[model samples]
Target: MPENRTEISELGEFGLIERLNQDVILRNPSTLKGIGDDAAVIEAGDHVKVVTTDLLIEGVHFDLSYAPLTHVGFKAVAVNVSDIAAMNAIPTQITVSIALSNRFSVEAVEDLYAGINAACEHYGVDLVGGDTTASRGGLVISVTAIGEAQKDQVSYRSGAKVNDILCVTGDLGSALIGLQILEREKQVYLANPDMKPDLEKYDVVTGRQLKPDARMDIIHELREMDIVPTSMMDVSDGLASEIFHICKASNVGALIYEDKLPIDKQTFDTAVELNLDPITCVLNGGEDYELLFTIDQKDFAKLEKHPDIHFIGHMTKAEEGKFLVTKSGTAVQLKAQGWKHF
Candidate 1:
């Protein structure tokens, strides 16, 4: 008889994660959090420790045909750092593990580490320890980041209150736009080996796609200004998806303004060039690595003038429903097309 089977695609990425994590029993009292937040939280003596991990597989998470190994290494660390930033914590240490096939020589691995070290230095985090192993497929990288924050200062996805202002840092949609450009160039190269790819003009979007920087600086600035986000999550799965997570976790709804949505000139233009809607890209595009958060109304004055941060919307009661108010004064239901991976 044939064995019973269920397609992973049917469950999707988040669904698969949820199913796998359903049985992750925490045996230690120190495990304040596990498999749910941007990072796990552990009870420390004076402060809480936030831990996060990310895995990058060749072809699936990245394509080496265009993505340089250095950038891949850098991104591997930055994504984890972004999660720590989402928790309003400062990254302190990281352990990097890599699985490489024989196709990668020692020098190639060293080049990857060069970028990893650079990211560590950039984020002010120490490299503690990790494992190295052989793989039959392409390269795989996984990183675990540890961060610390005062218990009170730690922001959770569940902290948003009604009337809290929804805030997003920097512009959105750039990374997705950048990815389109890269993919287009790759196709061009594959079609004709002699044709040189024209990439110089699309640097802004391509750079955003290739190597994204976590908004750790923004996190630091918030601490310096004595502001704590009521609820926060990193914009790894596009603005709309992250908003839905924040809303669900906090038991609230959000009202975001279409006009207030931030988009880069390059992103908008590229989206138009590719015949993709810029606004749709902003709403559903993923991997910007910016922070999506809600702040108390009283703290708005402190960040009102900050040029990088955008005040996009505010929180509402769950029954009010999640919406995006258009420039023409029409309200539309917000939809989440987060990373599907299934």
Candidate 2:
């Protein structure tokens, strides 16, 4: 008889994570959270530390043909920090490890670190330690970020309650549209090396793709307002997919409004130019790095006058199921078709 070989593709990314996490047992009393959240929470004396890591590979997470090494390094750090922010923590330190091929020279590595250093300064994080190794494959970067917050200030995906207001920061879908523009330009250049890429017109979208800023600004403002969100997560995945995560973890449902979804004018225009539905892009596009969170109804007034935060929807009973109330007054089931590594 043949040994049963389970294909990873059949399980998908989240499903695989779930399957592997099933048997893992947390034995330490200090391990406040192990898996199944944006970041792991470890108990500290008066405060808790939030830890998160991310892996970015060449040709997979980025294309060196278009993406500058500097931007890649910056993004690598920003993503991990974003995860920390999702837990309502202030990032303090990061350790960066990189695997390099011969293709990258010392100057190339310096350029990469230039971006990394810039991000470290930008986010007020220290580059405490890291590792380096040779790789036959292209560049690979791994970043582990440590953040601090009061034990009570930590937010988890499982904390959302029924009737809590759903809020999102910045805009959505711009990064995905920017990726499309970059890819289109890459193809154009490949077909004709003499032609220069005309990216000045698409600068906003392209910038969003090349260098995404984590919404740490919003996190700081939330702290100032003394509004600890009921639940939170960064929108590294698509808005809808992240909503699904919050709902599943919190054992609740969400009803987001179509008209309330935020999209930049440039993102909308470019998505249409690419023959993609803007709404779909906003819902399913990934890598925006914005914050998606829910707050108690009482806290809504505190953020209502805020410029960047948009109140899109509210949580509902688990039996209500997740849905999007479309502009046409149709309530449709929300789907998670975001970025899938598998």
Candidate 3:
């Protein structure tokens, strides 16, 4: 009585997107892009409009038990804004939709909106409009962000050229380390409800996990400096995974240096405490939300002195192969073990 049913896990998220993209037919001339890139591009007069969407489910994308609704709201907006920035566009508006069950009170919803409103103000984006509905399950939030930029200002994953300087913003691995600490504390709390979590010392790592700020500041700085990244993407997955994406998209290879990888002191310390290799955490950790971009070799001098940005390596010819040059002067092939829900 049952038909053949394939589990979504079998195909994976990217696989599903690839399959769906095959059936998509772009009809409108104004529609410059569909799926595949960080955001969809649309021709709009002198500039192009970039649109991106993300859906967050309670249990799958987040654990409501540990994740505060306020932080959840901020993260939801920051993630969407990150995509817009990846396209080298300035976010102008966002529409947020939420489906709630009776378990959440109106006051709780207000707390969530407080974060959303704060993010909107921080990013200078208007909360245009969205829909709300009753859900039998836990909270579900969907956000769509719209941004704009000049035709020439847009950066895509496919724009990296051989010999371009690979750059990363801020640090990596903090968020993943923070998650581990939170989970550990949560387990402790569950075992004995009276124990208060000593979270004061881990504020930096915890903040990275909760209220991640999108690097629109860097985007604005690039504009001010008159520099456009040859290629760009946000580090949602991990450094290694994101580098692989840029390489695959631009038909190039990369050679990163282990010593050049950026890991915060708190992240390194916490990772050591949790028995995770700090470098491994930097390479494979997820949700750092930093910008990973490539710049022309000539433009490197301009950004060389930037305190927050790190110059890890250079883009290489596809046949050169992706490699990580260790601190001891040994080279090893790079592997991407990004976050996988399935």
The best candidate by lDDT is 2
* lDDT of candidate 3 over 1-342, digit per residue (tens): 569988888998777878888988989999987777889999999999999999999987777778888889988999999999999999999999999999999999998899899899999999999999899999999999999999899999999999999999999999999888888899999999999999998999989988899999999999998999999999998999999999999999999999999999988998998999999999999999999999998898899999999999999999998999999999999998898878
Model 3: ten consecutive residues of lowest lDDT:
59-68
Candidate 2 lDDT, 1-342, residue by residue in tens: 669988899999988999999999999999999998999999999889999999998998999999998999999999999999999999999999999999899999999999999999999999999999999999999999999999999999999999999999999999999999999999999999999999998999999999999999999999999999999999988999999999999999999999999999999999999999999999999999999999999998899999999999999999999999999999999999979987
In model 2, which runs have C-alpha deviations exceeding 4 angstroms? none
Query: Clashing residue pairs, candidate 3?
Result: none
The candidate scoring highest on TM-score is: 2
In the order shown, what is each candidate's alpha-carbon RMSD?
1.1, 1.0, 1.1
Model 1 lDDT tens row, 131-178:
999999889899999999999999999999999999999999999999
TM-score of each predicted structure versus truth: 0.98, 0.99, 0.98
Note the clash tally of each candidate.
Answer: 0, 0, 0
Cα displacement (Å) at residue 160, model 1: 0.3
